[model samples]
Target: MNSHQPDLRAAVRRLGRRHFLTLTAAAAALAFATDLPAARAASVPELDARKIAENPFTLGVASGDPLPESVLLWTRLAPRPLEPDSGLPDKRVVVTWELAHDETFLRIVRGGTATAHPEFDHTLHVEVTGLDPGRPYYYRFRTGTWESPTGRTRTAPAPGTATSRLKLAAVACQAYHHGYFTPYKHLAGEDLDVVFHLGDYLYEYAVDSAGGSRAYTDRVLPAHFNREAMTLADYRLRYALYKSDPDLIAAHAAHPFAVTWDDHETENNYAGDTPENSVPPEEFLLRRAGAYRAYWENQPLRAPQQPKGPDMRLYRRLQFGQLAQFDILDTRQYRSEQAHGDGWQKARPEAEAPSRTITGETQERWLLDGWKDSSATWNVVPQQVTFAQRRDKPTADFKLSMDAWDGYPASRQRILDGAEAAGIKNLMVLDGDAHVGYGFDLKKDFQDPASRTIGTEISTTSVASGRDGADKPANWDDLTQANPHLKYYNGRRGYTVITLGTDRARVDFKTVSGVTKPGGTLTTAASFVTEAGRPGLTPA
Candidate 1:
């Protein structure tokens, strides 16, 4: 490390915190911004197909961000996925894609050509339009003689169509070193209209050369992946490693996913404009820029979701006719730092500060306004972290997860109060993280068991982060006893299935027996039904 670096950071910190961060963030990405067009300008570097040694579609293909009439298709040309440059030359390659009505490509409907520039890591995104609403479409990409794996995607129901039903699966937290992606394989086979990946798509931590917990004896991974991701190339390579999993690829191919990121996508428990460790904000912003850009290139996001410097607008709404309206949130990007210095802590005055916000002012306003005008029968919210309050033990001096909504009392209160004011009768909240499944009746006052059940929150277990977990965790009894609002709890590796019909909503807590080994058994641990105009969980 440079001896003078500390002095430089100290000088930078003298300026106003908010304004200085904005300036430094822009400064950090200026060079990256200026370099993109330079590489894009030298775009004509085509070579004969015979000269290429192997197929470049090793990463497979995916489609996401579905609309009533359109959906985005994504694929990267990665003959060698873990390479720094994805093993592709610094040239633009013309990739053609076809959307067909059948899996065999027997009936081609939409076709187009897009240039996959190395400036954007040779990823291709084709937004297909002019399609019938509430239908399935098969798509694939081709360049020269090589073709990608066929992917199936479905569009949302038409607006005001009075849809009778909607099916969705929520998943997240797939750390490669923890276990195998067995849950995704099971999820791929389930009949769902759409999938929502609630973040932590990939961890920033290092993986062993033997492929971490999987302990791969068949092959050894590269040494570059044995360290934390810190640079743009590092983050990109990390994504390639996670995406190369066959089960994850299969899940993407099976259904279009709407995704949002959590802390692990950049760093663990990092708050808005604040690094988890004691790292300088300027340095963290530079790292965040790389993480954000790599996220955009890899995911099947549209142009509107693209990143600028260290910022990206990932929060948006997706409606499924009149059955459900999903307000996808980005809580990690705008939350205040973890109060009381991380981990579980008792309530503190700083945590209750009205000025300390989880969703920044603008996003809070957006969410409130969206709720006020919502028309769907079930107003669903897919966000990071737990919503209901969770205490450590059955006592008045109980501690709570400082990283979750429990630390942001004021923010949670505003949201809960807003729901009641808007006359939101059937409110549903889907949360990720915790590495365990929890069904909570969101209440206005946790101290009172009879408090109004303002909403319902179904928190899904991790995909593979916690390895093979048991049904009853060590603190299961304590957690269930202390928090009366918490109706269910299970420590397992799996996702959750949420189905909305015309009159009611049902949530199934799906659990996998194991993820350390292949072919884990998937079973519904529990199921709950909440009737329309009644915000509570009833055993189904």
Candidate 2:
């Protein structure tokens, strides 16, 4: 076992003290109700395991990627409720899945059988193909005598088809300990074509550990995560616990998901070889290897994402027929550490810097060359973190966070320069991370007032996790004012919805009252639009 495990345990113990105090306050509030007949009664409500078995798939079934011919289906078999801690069972069960053109069983199209092994924590990913495009389908899974609830899914129209429009939702940053995922539950109710998960899907922290920035609130998670996850079983159990959330599963079942991971999937502020928590170089690699393996096994990704040790090349292009092409980029795992300097200084070694890289040499060339050659009307770069260069003035003493693309100035400039050189039109950047929403005009130089805008970016805030504690609103507001490029900023939790049409694209920023609460109302706080050939964002 790693020596650092002791340090992590100590941190959790310290955090427990604070949690106990909060619980005491809650107990005091409930103490008044003790006089009621129900409270005075000696018997308490009891839960029976046999009753829960009647609904084996309580977490629900989900499908993603409704393509003209295929869609990915997912489900987990939780056979033993009493053994929730391990989320593993020794017995292997045969899982049967079927897809139909209609909600009823009359038009069955595809069917298959697979085994849910204990090694994968009883979770299964079934990619069903050979279905008609642009048509809705319903699917379900069966294990022994238990049947999962049916889920609906649809595929994208074939390339260059006569489809009029497409609706997609963008979201990210869901830390289970931070808040409830009520926003996802709301998004699942909408009629969407696909969901774009930009990143920060799971946080790698022990449950009792005080969220680095805030105290625990009303959100629920496992009672204890005593150590940093390094083994495959540890990672598997973490994903299982997260996937069990009904809201997340509902959203996944409602529409297809296009996903990418940000720092928290491994560690906060992780650069190429170094993580923010500063695990030794050798140990970091091993942890990364296990983390990547778990990520691939849990996600509904294509075969290309199969993990090989610590590396899983996730940057790839997904075409949505003739309407658009998504070039998902990986900004982590291949960048230099933060530059050392005084104040908000610009990175030195501008043109000849051989050490700085964001997309790496190969991926950068691939992205630029792909942009130059693509024929789609919209060039969408669905990536993690912000791309717009954010800088604090010389006297402000603010520098770029080493974890984001801003740390690699040379490479960022090159990508922008490539777009200019390629004359790529209608370039839209979908960004996450930074826990705040922003719509910026991506300019070659932010310092220069006369700098021309190159493209447009729509940054989504955190789905659940963000700035916690007393300074929340103040910090968010100050960041927004400092960065004039930001169009909207909210300390509250929520997600974004985008609709792409032939001539225009509309983006709606939806915020929930609070994720710390079980359920919250959602409202569109702001909206923006981008015309097909204009390439810049405008108020909707």
Candidate 3:
């Protein structure tokens, strides 16, 4: 491959052999159409299965950010997915989407034609509205007689109504090459209203261990991903590769996902525009813009979340009638540079500085305002990273992970204080990123173990990143002892199933026995519930 061009084979290899198939010459023609001049691109022929090599719906379908009356639907045309241009011609193609009350489309509620723009990597995001609240809908997309798999999505209950309960799953950190996304298979089987993915959706590490600490897989890494994603095309292709997972696709088709990124989406441990490696400010901003754009294009997010250069407005609020208010946060884009340059370290004055914010000024203010305005039975903060303070060692010394909220002491305190001031009775915090799962009681003050408990936190484990992690970490007992607020901890590959009710919120720490191969058995490793108006977990 030439130094200037991306390695298409490497992009396909990221999906591994199980999910991706080599495309035929006809399909390859579509992908390489980018090599043609702009005038020739306009004259590209229509796609036909007999003329093409593979199915364009290789990436499947997804829905997200569901409102009471509207939902965002997504699909990408990837006949030759591993190809540099997803086997799509260098022009916009028309895609027809249909939403109905039945899976058969017999009762079409909404139907429209949308363009799959080559500018956005041939991905389609159709925002369908005017649907009744709290109703389940089936949607599908098609072009040239080829149809996408039907996806199921539910609109949120009408706001201000007295909703009784909500079922949600919080999942994150699925490194495609690390292992199978078996957890998503289980997540798909669950009855969840919505899914929250707290970042590391796709790791930017190269296929080789030399690029980062990620486990090297047998599959070859693309030259573009051999280091870190730097260009818009690189990030877009990376997202396409990860979206090829059948399990991941099924999960997305099953439920709407509210996503937020932690590190590894662009580069490992990237803090805002400051990359882990010493890339120049302008270069890093360009890379961030690419990453953000690719993320929005691939996911079923709305147009409002589109990236403006390096900046994207991701932190927003979603209401579930009177049952819950989800304050989906973007912790990565706004956070100040990781104090002490990232990783676990002894607490420093700078780490706790009031100005060292993780959510930035605008987003933090938005979150605080959401808390104040919320009138739902449960106020849930769906975010990345642990919310409660965690001491790494068992000793009396103060050592916390600089990568988490523990590093932004003042910011965390403000959130906790805001929750209290808002008279939040059932403040539930949902987060992911520590491949290991954790259950914690949100503390009003972490310095005092006996301080008033402000809420409950359910930190989900990785979808597969840890591979087949042990049932428990080596120092599990010590860590739990060191942090009294932490109720449970498990080192496993899975997600958390949460049931929020008017009287209580129950959480089942669902763990997969393994991820090295497909078909891992999912079992509830632990169950706990926090009663309404009272904080802290009790045996469910």
lDDT of each: 0.86, 0.69, 0.81
| Model 3 spans with C-alpha error above 4 angstroms | 1-53, 208-227
What is the TM-score of each predicted model, taking all chains together? 0.95, 0.82, 0.89
What would the per-residue lDDT of candidate 2 be over residues 296-325, giving only the tens digit for each residue? 767777667755546778888777777877
lDDT of 1 by residue, 141-173 (tens): 888889889999999999898999899999989
Clashes of each: 0, 6, 2
Model 2 poorest ten-residue lDDT run: 1-10
Per-residue accuracy of model 3 over 45-70 as CA lDDT, tens digit each: 44443444567899999999989999
Better of 1 and 3 by TM-score: 1
Span of ten consecutive residues with least summed lDDT in model 1: 1-10
